[model samples]
Target: MLLRKPAASELSAEPILSAAENYSGEMHAIDTGVRVDAVEFARGRVALGRLLAKRGIGYGDRVVMAVANGPLFAAALCAVLARGASPLILHAKTPAAEMRRYAERYAARMVFGDGSSETEYRETGLEPYLVEAADWARLLCANVKIVDESAGNVSLVLPGVPLHPTSGTTGQPKVALRPGRPAIAEAAHYIETTGIQASDTILVAAPQSHAYCYGMGTMVPLLCGASIITMRGFEAGLVQSALRDTNVTVVPAVPAMLGSLMFGTRGDLFARVNTVFSAGAPLNEKTAKAFANKFGIAVRPLYGTTETGGIAISLPGSQAVAGICVGPAMKDVEVDVRDDGQGLAPGLGMTYVRSESMMTGYLDENGLDQSFVVDGWFKTGDIANQDTEGRIYLHGRQSEVINVAGMKVIPSEVENVLLRISGVIEAKVYSREHRTGSQSVQAAVVAHGVDDADVRAHCEKNLVYYKRPSMISFVEALPRNATGKIDMAALSNL
Candidate 1:
């Protein structure tokens, strides 16, 4: 576990429902054909609160939620918060056994999942709260007036907030525990920074379970009265179709999805889109330029981690200086780079950030560990530098840096060079360990009619000798995890 919690005295808890209550937007689902406005969503939230109360879920009790993305998921999130239950959201397809394990590991009071997962959860000896789209719709839009038992009560204390899981690219995944005040503060900052409006319709193709989509796609927009259109998963055809059919002005996508959109038709494909935000992984210059050249739109690189909520984002129409630059620190957020004491430049080193919205700590099996944060800053484990213009340029994960004969090689730098070569569609660079205890740079490439020689030749022209890939393997596709990030652990086998 790389992160630990701060002291309990440093944490402050507030009700997250205050933000949800301010939402006057709408949620539209592509697959389920369910449209819920703010009023409907609130009604459903209150009703769901009753259901959770019946299940004996309340303040400080942890609940595991594996519901799929849609209006219902958003409602369920709010309802869980309303009942003052800390909620941990997992991937919708997570097996019932794994869900139960996480529940036990986290000491959750109950598990909430979609209708499809009900039987499996029951078979696992857990009576899960099954959320059906039809049932949710009826709860929200039904004509029957929902009686509120504690609508006027002011004594309730909400200490529960949403929890997130790390992507585990560096190691095993750990759960992030956050306070309600910081979580709501982060959502407000994101909504204000992005300028999300009531009239704008945002398209969400990324996994809603992830922090990026959960905040930017669902919470940010809804909290500010902006509508959202969600797709269960990202497919080029489906996403493009939704963009063409709907009036989606903002599209928050990962780099993988943006790269996939490069091969398809783009004749007015993004006619109505004025903003596009990319995160989760580094946005290679190839895809950035290609998307801009083809669609006449600039790709804003948003930078943050699940544990940090949101730290920085390139505003609309910001140009990438040198490489891709995730713009300056967001409002009320402080960002800086620390020197590694290895002769790095003045403003270039490990990225450290601190904000009210950052997570309180990491949840381990034993209990809360409060050691990750030093003083007030959290080490982000990323090699980054702030340009003179105050834009953030990421090198790569510090753990992903390759050491060859005591020299350093950033994989993202090498991968970017590979992507510049003709016919190269995807590229991932890593360090390969030899039996003699030395590491050599290796690359896995997905390209069209490109071989090792072509890759080497390009590297020779662009990268230093040690920085160039010593070995290259051409494959049809790169293996990716559920969150659209390349599975670094699985790359060593290649």
Candidate 2:
């Protein structure tokens, strides 16, 4: 059966009540051993909204939410949205200094978290509303008055509000502000592209604070009336158990985490999942092929950023396309491949997206304005090539591209080549400043029983002379950030 396209009107409607009415009888979430119904979730959100309003939280207020993915987190997001406030969903595991910095950067007026987080925030000299899991039910149920179900004035503030942080592999994370409608549209597009349905169950192992989880993991399922089973963190064992125990049909994961699941001790446990969405970083061909061979399910590669909601381009399982192609631009989203340096079109340059999911902008005391775009399109900063058939293939971040003697090389190309090596477990390639004056190609590899000579020989077969790594360092493991992406800054220091 063909999945119907989501109505634009529904996309513009309030996300809080949309899932409630659509999936009223369906189970909405499974956190640990607790199962929450859609109706109960909606009521909780309403009550929480009222409670927050009473605490002086109002429309356009920035609420820094440092929490994990669970019933309380979902309720908090809904409550904030209901109260016409925007949620800056911070990673619960983020260092306190970074969290405090973000709160200060965004000029956040209110903060919400558990007792421990609240204590940490207080230590940082910010007095925030502290709500624990035990009291969340009571707090949300305290004020049960009917409030405006309309998306409220907070949605209007979205066009200029920086609400979330963009993960930076090479530098400090930046805040990306997305208007409410764009977020809703992105969620709607995700549902349409993936054919999400009320009967489908989504397993969210990714961090909800990130765009991938915010859209595919949380928003998409809720908007489409599908249930969500959220795991607080990514664990191969926990993921396997969820897949086998729950009716989890859809999963969104980063390539590294997916690689661990496919090649780790729990490799064979993902056979029950019907569809898998891989994103956050470049998805290599080996992992893609291995996942399909092992699970009889296609690993759908998606491309997008915090600046552009969940998926800008994606391929469905029904599609025969495979490997690192991100399929096509989603409906209501436009992708352009521009010329390098010039930023003009028809060459392998930077990718630009014009979509409903475009962020408002990065925030500052001067307020949000033109920081991410030239005209109407958001500069993706990702280097990609669009084929004649309109399929997008991401190479690597334009900023991370290695320039060896004026020759440009994408790290993903080198990384893919190294992964093909016999004993290589994982590989990352970057550019390092040489004492001789120019930047040289460097590679850090994680392998078992493989030496630098073996990796160089492997690279020799795949990469050109200038593209090969001049310096190769073998590490036990690559340093990754909270979101499981390679920490290039840390690598540079090494």
Candidate 3:
């Protein structure tokens, strides 16, 4: 009942599909050198949907797509959903074997992959349909792809939703099922809150597979009749060039990507860009301030999880509260904190959120995992505090909290102290377990001129005995996943 049926003359025209047909601007895939206007995008999706339906991807069928951020991803998503099939997205760089493993594990009916991964899919008996940006020009314009015009124009019936895999910062990734109407509602909320206009152009450097980028980077822009240019992956040089060449008005990125772009730049590059959204990971004070100082625009913090499409975002021109605020709850979203007695600040506690856009439940081996929800609220497993004006200040995830003999050490608090030390570029604080079954605080730092002793001296002066790092290792860089969150598993091995 949420999505009204489109007219018989229209092709799969729902909210996002309808917007694609009505809007006129182009969506570009920089790596593939492909660009198409809204009408072309809509037609391409319809054609692709028919192809998928013919391939036996219909109601209740789940298809796994290992496509990157580009026109192919956007068009393919609409196509799969329009066919009443669930689509599971994986990172483009995900290996062929891993892609096949996920497909088999998730019981996917088929797979859709790029040219590079097609052979692996076929070898694994996945029978993947190869989707290429190079083929898009022909696919979008060629009427031959759609055998029956009337069948293509028939109403798009939805019987399945999209599936998203959690970032798995703490452990193995979990599959999340998000209902169709709620996901669309979340996209509409984001468009209204961000004030996205029909003329605005968004540069989506983040991978489209992630829920945050899928909404802000793709769906919100399309639904608002705005243009979007997508990159296969995050690259500082290509992003800078895109900014210089394209009329980009908005940029949606993670904290690490924003931090990387702060160097070797003049204020003029982002002169036309009005909004820069930082999510996926914590937005440090240094990165936010340096970006604002260089470009005259502050990086707005957007807080969300794979389980929830988007929760809160800092409003335009809002000041950061101690350089750690995610402004306020999104429209129709409820956010609150609960005391877990884990030794946080006075008001800080475990963060909980409930929203219309929240996933139905986590997909597990047995079936769905609704145990994560209490009443109607989803426990976010984040340590945070909310002010009277309703802004949320995040410390870090509860799982990331390092407990030193009953004393809790928040990683962000220690990382912030390290950043204050001169020459320290990046820092990650984690717990190291000893042979005696006790956890000790360990810090890994990336710095230009600072050494272990200097870091030790600074921490001794600023932090309590238990909160200070027992071991410090200097590294050239921190290992981060595709979404820019520190790969804790990789860090532990280091």
Best by lDDT: 3
TM-score, every prediction: 0.89, 0.85, 0.89
Q: What range of 10 consecutive residues in model 3 has the weakest lDDT sum?
A: 137-146
Deviation of model 2 at 41, angstroms: 0.6
Assess candidate 1 and give its lDDT. 0.75
Across residues 251-332, which tens digit of lDDT does each residue of candidate 3 receive?
A: 9888889878877766789998999998888787777877888888988889888777789999887655425688898888
The local distance difference test score of each candidate is 0.75, 0.68, 0.75
Ranking by lDDT: 3, 1, 2
lDDT of 2 at 462: 80
TM-score of 3: 0.89
* Deviation of model 3 at 375, angstroms: 3.0
lDDT of candidate 1 at residue 54, scale 0 to 100: 71
By summed lDDT, the worst window of 10 consecutive residues in model 1 runs over 138-147
Model 1 agreement with the true structure over 1-494: per-residue lDDT tens digits: 33433443344334357667888878888766778888888888788778767757777667777767778777777777777677788887777777777776666657666633456766777654443334543221101111332332112222566778884335568877767666767778887787777889989888888988887887677557788888677778878778888899999988889878888766578889989988888777777877888899988888888877888898677655424588888998888888977444356688888988777767665455446767767888888888787778888887788889988888877887888888997789999988988899999999998888888888999988999988888887888887788887788887
Q: Write down the TM-score for model 2.
A: 0.85
